[model samples]
Target: MTGSASRPRAVLIAGPTASGKSALALSLAERAGGVVINADSMQVYADLRVLTARPTVEEEARAPHRLYGHVDGAADYSVAHWLEDARRVLAEAGGEGRLPILIGGTGLYFKALTQGLSPMPAIPPEVRERVRALDLDAPALHARLASVDPETAARLRPSDTQRLMRALEVFEATGRPLARWQAERTEPPVLPAEEAVRIFLATDRTALRTRIATRFHVMMEEGAMEEARALLARNLPADRTVLKAHGMPWFARHLAGGITLDEAIEGAILDTRHYAKRQDTWFRHQLKGWSAMTVEEAAGLLATMA
Candidate 1:
């Protein structure tokens, strides 16, 4: 009774893609009076709804969902922005006395909730312009980043252009590498991990791979090709963030007669499965403190805690 006297009954349902997290969140919401909170990065973009797998029409109707696909596709949203939004939702839910179930596959968002996010400054335009001048070749950018932020560079795969650009931009803006800033900060989180029941609903890799493949096929059958083609005809920049949605370019090309539909489907499935693998590795290594449990187990734990 002493420990249960004051607990903010919140639930976090997170895992890799195709991990049945949405279903779990729905179930938890029904039983616990919780509203689902968006945690997926791609799902935050309004334009990539189908490609990003934002929850379906049925799912949204099942429970209240906050902050899904609410951002401009062109807008740059960081983990910090998401954390602020999450705090607002948490506050609202707490006031309403509704259970708050944060759900998605984004490990970084969960990390930000448990461990304080670093207060990194915005990159100055001059720094952005400088990095923009460098060729986009993977190795060249990787080398450039290595010269500035060796710690981040050492971990980045050569092909990680997004991260390489970010690392270099941070170094140029601050006149110091990102690694230095990260090493210096030691602030506690706004929410202690113990305050909420945390769960990472990892699925079996093989089963997840099959689910990814089947889902991609379903997507195509459900008009994904048309979706890509429509976006392409908008004449958005190939480098535009929306144009680069997962598997979008390939489907756009395939629809344009540059490749067979069969090849596009295969490529899309492969890319998603690979992404799932990376998510698995990240949650396993980086989230060492959060206790790992299946979705049901996590719900059970939360129930007993209350």
Candidate 2:
């Protein structure tokens, strides 16, 4: 990783959903004359703004924001795409002499910004279709991957269907395991850790759960269901990542009459809470050398940086 001798060029605020990341970023940007650059995967979609809990229009107007709701929902935006966009935004911030504050719950995005991502060989369309056509659940796919690329399979959860399939596809296309490619990182990190003030908000689990549930209710009040309906109306592919935005599938099921609205709300809340838990775990295990603190503590620390 590269190091910078000057003061920190950027601030990174990462945490679980409903952990006050957006609010804190906005406040810090306002104080520091910074640009708020999004690192959240879901919030990048223009289709599910409400469900993804993007900043309000008024809040966005308070500070310069970049990379929020910029991609079409039909597009399968990936970490590589986000990284490319972020590089440009970071460069612009540097040229304009503004502090760049990147805030989100997506651990992979943060990791990509700090430690460079590995470049995987592209899977041919035929290989991808074959993998997608296989009649197998996540566990079955994982078992299959274990037969071919046990090293990569051992690292992935059996329940992580998306990543499991990706690993399997890589194995099928290339003769090597996914792990081999990951061991050789060709893409350099955009913001090396030494150049940024990196923080992970460590909210109490109970408090975070309560906040997530409460915020889900607030999203409902803000027409998250309607947002889901509009996105659904576009009839995008079910595999599209945007369709899996928190509360989106539940709302779709509710709209389709397969579940009651109340049930959908409860399901979405449970899913979001579980996702928050996963976010916390990923940061703890995957990200290194980041200060872990409560939101209040983070605010104070970032205030000095601002």
Candidate 3:
């Protein structure tokens, strides 16, 4: 039998932010006896619910929700961590005869679920700290990485500090290129795509941009500043994933009196728009065979899946 045939079928709902994927997932979960699980990386952190646009308590109460706010903001929550949690959740849902609805805009998470992920060795704290202590600019780090692991360095943009640092850390930890480890991957995919109904919410570019702007505005009005303030006060380590959240830098500046609230909002909206655009592009190219539809259409299709 194929991989999917041995497991209960799951539904994967993916889309750019503000595309109404969460609402659609909730409606479908309520109707289809499915549990709505978070696939978005940001939503896993408890620190930025409003800014991350995580499902509200009322929405979550409407359906079974899993993995939302299960992680602390200061934690180094990696894809491996998420994949492990997700596999457990999937098994639990299967055991209960409940459909599993995985929904999020994080393309990497969905990809890992369907297409298996290569194992990355854990970088030692000393090596990680050494890299972080350099505080090198992206270009300088990229140059440094190029000297040690040119193949990985070539693949990353000079401005991609996180990825550059990751590559450098891997090299420092293992004396091997990150690409080499990736090529050695043998782990099996957790969710076979053929066994799941994949839905991609496609919105018009203009509409998505407008929605992005509106959502940020709402976030500001809905205690997003307070959330940012609280998180900043915790003084978490720099490499924590929560600090890389969209609007974080701008919010920090606003909190520090380095920028006006209006400027921070504008910056956050622009960043979100760029991120949404990247998400749209990624789903279009990386996710094959998914049924791309509007949110309304997706809600209608859920009954068929159920």
Candidate 4:
């Protein structure tokens, strides 16, 4: 076996957007005859393919790929939902004795694989809507959560609307604080620690920011505006998962005459730069223990293994 005898062979290729994560994963999969598994949250949904920059069809044909572009936009897919999907794929891949390569930039997906997830049920859409309508005003919503579930409320930052809403809903539905429920449901990680080698692509932040900005420009040149326009014209509320895509809001601003196309495109670049910075920060501190390698280094490393 490629991995420890007790655990199935697996490889993880993770990094920020526009960092060539998909290419690396595909190369590794081709070398090892491994199956590529999607680990990015956005890439799971069926819609927003061009926006999410999912793997191209030619790339999928180069290796066995799973879980890419599988769900519809209407689904409020959570980490729990993704975990369930991954667990099934892991089991299936292990049974077939095929190496599994989990790849993408969504940090939470990797976190769930390694550290295990809290047993929180999906929060209702209405409850989430109510929380979001509170409009990122931390103090006011914090005050509301404090009245009903002070323990859970105490742990959340005032601006954490998504989490605060989840905690509040759990309290209302179960008559218990969300923290208490988390305590009760902690379980062993589904993906064994020794089964996989974790590798992170380390690109220079400045270089990566330039790449992000450049890619957004390419996306625009490649009909991203039309894609965004169609998606926006769907009349889905701003809070819908599809409408909240990273580049959508800025483009929507342009569409609504709030800004010019030039300004909107510039905003997209700036936003992507900031997103890359955040991803770099997360990979550094949050994934501190993982092996860090450059793109060239990764290619060399895979060559050796092959």
Candidate 5:
């Protein structure tokens, strides 16, 4: 989190989808002579750029943007990979005498950058496949995890398959609990939170829901389905994160003739709303000491920082 005696190193803009985060990031970058580095997991994939609502060509032309749409759809991109990319971008921005404006809806990226991520060993491919193939219900798997890694199991809810499976996979691969690896992290924080302007956009819940639905419909109209069609043609692994991007699976179903377009739209809208809610909840609890404000308020605050 070190910065020059004169100025902070970066500005972090975090919020739920459709919360105007991209606009704010662009505004801040324009003002602060910064480069916009992506923090969103979905935006990293090249295949679902429109579906992920990445910045448009015009918006990007206005400023230097890095790490967006740089990943292939079939690659198993992870948070660790993003962290490494972000570190390099931050260095590049610094060397260019520009601030690094990290923006996205993903809280984990912010957490990893600020708090430092555990250099946990990778799970073997077979271990990943074995865990993904298990059809056990959440509670059953939680019970199994409880036996091998009771500490992590107790911390996570029974319904949280993502974390539970990750913990199980880590233990199965390395014969050590995920918690143990996390506790042994030796890396320093990537970006010190104390030296950054951290802004979280908290919009009106009903208005956000409206924006999510409206923007999703816009994506459908603006070639999101075509993006999905191309991605489907690739036949990427189902377990890949790109396949689970908000509304992606529903759009895929629609393209496959398994569902009506209207139904697909409704399902995508519902899933996005759920995801946004989770993002809001996670930021509320996980991100501490960040100033939560509306888009306009954030812009005004960034002016002071500039």
Candidate 6:
């Protein structure tokens, strides 16, 4: 693996939703001649622009943006896919002599970029279908995983249906626990920590809660409902990642006459605030060696780079 000193410099901005990460990244990118890359998983889908709070058209017009709204909603995009796309974009940015500024709240994407990822075996379509069709709730799935792969099951939360399902599928396909495969990871980090300026934007909890609620309201007024309608019109599978974008389920309920628009808006707002809390917690615990600062402080630090 190449040393960090041999790698080109990049910037990484991460934080909870409504934390102004996009604005900071755009401001720095425009002044520094940097390419803004999407690190948030949901923002990559073309179908959830408003709900995901992806950069607006005007924002994209102001600077070079990569990987935003570039994936089909029906596809099951994963961190592996994101890392590959990021590698390509980072290379492109380097070749063009532009700084690469990756921004998002997805901690796993940043982790994979700096710490590499495990190489899991390919899961056949039949195995995936079998695992997904087991007619079990998350806790039940976790129990089932315990029977086959106790180590992995113990590590995953009983409430995490997606990860439980993935663990089950891995065990079924390879006759080994997912943890075993993860232990064999040999991929090198694409951008080592020493080669980049990493910052996690911190906001007071009360202020962040207010911001999240306000942002959801703005999203709805700006056509989040219509965006949800279009995405639902596609009839993607329930398990598709895009279907679970924040506010989507609530909007779906509202559109289906199961709830009023006001109820939908409130539900979306509440859920988003909860998600933001989770994002903040995850970054604090999982992302190490990252500078934590308010937006203004980060901007000041980044201005020097420009």
What's the TM-score of each model vs. the native? 0.77, 0.82, 0.82, 0.81, 0.82, 0.82
lDDT on C-alpha atoms for all candidate structures:
0.74, 0.83, 0.83, 0.74, 0.83, 0.84
Please report the candidate that would top lDDT against the real structure.
6
The reply for model 3, stretches above 4 Å from the true place, is 1-8, 119-180
lDDT of 4 by residue, 1-306 (tens): 245433337777888788888888888788777889998867886767777788777888999899998987765666667788999999898898678889887776787677676467433332344455556466777887898778778888988876776776655333456766677866677785555778899898788878887777777777788888887777765445666666888889998999999998888788667676677677677664687999998777666554
Candidate 3 backbone clash number: 0
List, residue by residue over 1-306, the lDDT tens digit for candidate 5.
356533577889999999999988898788778899999878999888789999999999999999999999878666667888999999899899998889998787788788776546544333565587678899998999999889899999999999899998876544567787778854688887897878899989999999999999899889988888888888877766688777887888898889998999899999889778878887888889998999999888777656
- Screening candidate 5 with a backbone cut-off below 3 angstroms (N, C-alpha, C), the clashing residue pairs are 1-192
lDDT of 3 by residue, 1-306 (tens): 132432338889999989998888888788778899999978999999998999998988888999999999977666668899999999999899888999998877788788776457555343565578787898999999888788888899999999999988876544567887777864789998888888899999999999999888888889898899999999998666687677887999998999998999999899888878878887888888898998888877776655
lDDT at position 187, candidate 3: 73
lDDT of 1 at 16: 82
Q: Is candidate 4 or candidate 6 better by TM-score?
A: 6
For each of the candidates, give the backbone clash count: 0, 0, 0, 0, 1, 0
Which scores higher on lDDT, 1 or 5? 5
Superposed by TM-score, candidate 6 places the C-alpha of residue 90 at a distance from the truth, in angstroms, of 0.1
For model 6, how does the per-residue alpha-carbon lDDT over 1-306 read when each residue is reduced to its tens digit? 222432339989999989999999999888889999999978999988888999999999999999999999987677778889999999999999998999998887898789776466545343565578689999899998898788988898999999999898776544567887788865899998877988999999899888888888888789998999999999988867687777888888988999999998888888778778878887888789999999999988887876
- lDDT of candidate 1 over 1-306, digit per residue (tens): 112522455776778888888877777676667788998866888776677778888889988889898887656665667888888998898898778888887777787777766556444332455578666798999988887688989988999988889888776544567787677874576566777767787677888899898888777777777777777777765445556556886788787789998888888788778778877777887666666777667666666533
Q: After superposition, how far is residue 283 of candidate 6 from its true place, in Å?
A: 0.5
Question: Residue 38 lDDT in model 4?
Answer: 95
